[model samples]
Target: MIQRAETEHSKELGCAKHLLLAIGSANVIGVSLPASLSSHAGPGAGQGRSVFFSDGVSRIRLTLDENSPVLIENSGETAVLTFDGPGGLISVEGFVEKTGCHCPKQAYITINEGCIFSCRYCNVPNLDKHIKTPDEIASLISDAVRRENVECISLTSGVVGTMQEEDERLFAILERVRPFGLPIGVSVYPTPGLSQRLFELGVSEVKFNLETATGKLFAEMCPSLDRDVLCNALKEAVGIFGKNRVYTNIILGLGESKAEMKQCITHCLENGVIPIIRPLTPSAQLSHFSRPLAEDILSISEFLQSELLRFGLDPSASKTMCAKCMGCDLTPMTDLHLGEVTP
Candidate 1:
């Protein structure tokens, strides 16, 4: 009976893995929440109000759309997700998770909602702009710590002024929250001395998003940003932050080829930086792009996991940010759960 239960658990996890990718690879899903249910928008722009759904094994952050073919209905302790299948409707059972901050057990805060640069795919600049003061940020973190299951504190921001100015603002906010003594992770545009400064601030980890896979695509997409600066920060971040502590976000379905994805993943692994495989969310500004298929997401995730293992970096070791959250992207060692890692 124990052997049979273990086999059933394995099969359940396999199903959950596929379902998570399926839900994440899509731009929207069908879910109806009671009007009384609280709504929370992610820190970034262009993101719709989303909810975290977790099965017993894995979790996914899904953007709700009433018209989507994939529908989720709340059922007492869990929820039932029904989607159109090749044969008919298929349903999976899970529960909609409640989060204290942007995600569960972590207060993911955004210092500023405005950006000066125009990254074609991002919708932050187009959204209404707001910069939270250090006191306000501290209050938010303090309240989450006092009232919720807050474990880590994370901060990301749009470049409202200059990168230096943003860094200064981030430092001010960091000073306010340092009293809480929680592991803090930050994601921002890399500026000179940013990595070393953040390390000295007692930050546990840091993320510098690459966004795209290659220089050519990066040049075309993020023309205002310097690829070299970002790369240099990533390298320095790995060295200062140590292995499994530095990360980068590489969004799929931005017209990047599989080869490009593999090459970028290899580059990050070579540098001891873990790459986050995020699916592109199609927006009005980026409607030309398509969301990657579930299979494509899985393929890249497998490749990333193999490379991370090869480089002696482990995503499961990450303490803060997306790697620890495992909400938005298919994290390598954490999500795939392929085999045991050698410490």
Candidate 2:
């Protein structure tokens, strides 16, 4: 009986990795953050603040929302995360990680806080626009590096103007921070010749989000953006950046079936681009959509892990962005271990 009980506990630990991801993809917390954590000024202030929760083995990022079923309470040195599961109330132990800027050990900065294209599901297009000057960008990165000991720098932006204008603006910012001697990554709406230009700028990695599993949904959700251009950009990125250095986001719960999601993952892997299976964050614009179930997330992520191994791609090899952070999704190598968890 003792041996049987030990086996059950071991299986639960294996599932625990997926369980943590489901909680993160749900992106909610039931309790108000204690003053110790809330006082820290970080990203997504206008929206809800986010918390990084790490079990000793893996970490997941969750947003603070009183409406969620999950509750986190501080213990002596760690926090107890409790939630009502199908069986009963389940509790897990971990601690809240203080990130360097937007994520741990990286200065993830946004160049433009607003977008010109009105993607119905995204909130950035509706937010008040703010473009950071080059000097301001340098100062922010400098501060994060000094205070947080950041190892990499990541830059993302909403398209606030013409594609050319945005690219030029990014180039200017890149020039200012080049001397910092940290690996840099950029995520932007791709333009012709953008990948080569970025490689010439000494960028270590690049990401262009496909953001949808199928072309039909892509057209419906992001009507103004061309899916073909995005696909070509991703392929081109793999060529310039080489394998394991290029990444893209194939967001889940956007009305895509499992087969479609797998096909999308296959396309990315075939081209040597690492795909991020990000869960949809519900918002006023996308109120009709719901977050994907934890089971669905785990199953799909398991498929991703297998395919990644088949293709010889490694998420751990990425130098920047969501792949490096592993906060927002079920990252393959870092979070999903194959038969390695033990009770």
Winning candidate number (TM-score):
1
Q: What TM value does model 1 have?
A: 0.88
lDDT of all predictions: 0.74, 0.76
Candidate 1 segments whose C-alpha is farther than 4 A from its true place: 1-44, 85-90
Best-fitting candidate, scored by lDDT: 2
Tell me how candidate 2 scores on lDDT.
0.76
Look at candidate 2 and tell me the lDDT of residue 2: 8
Q: Report the lDDT tens digits of candidate 1 across residue range 1-343.
A: 0011111122233345544455542222334443212222232245556666666666677766555555566764677665544334455577776665677788888788767888888777776788999999988888778877798999988888876788899998888889998899999888878889998888999999898999998998898999889999999998898978999988888898999999999998898888988887776368676677878888888898888778888877777878888877776655677874675
Q: How does each model score on TM-score? A: 0.88, 0.87
In model 1, pairs of residues that clash are none
How accurate locally is residue 137 in candidate 2, as Cα lDDT from 0 to 100? 87
> Which stretches in model 2 have alpha-carbon errors above 4 Å?
1-14, 20-46, 75-77, 339-343
Candidate 1, residue 116: CA error in Å?
0.6
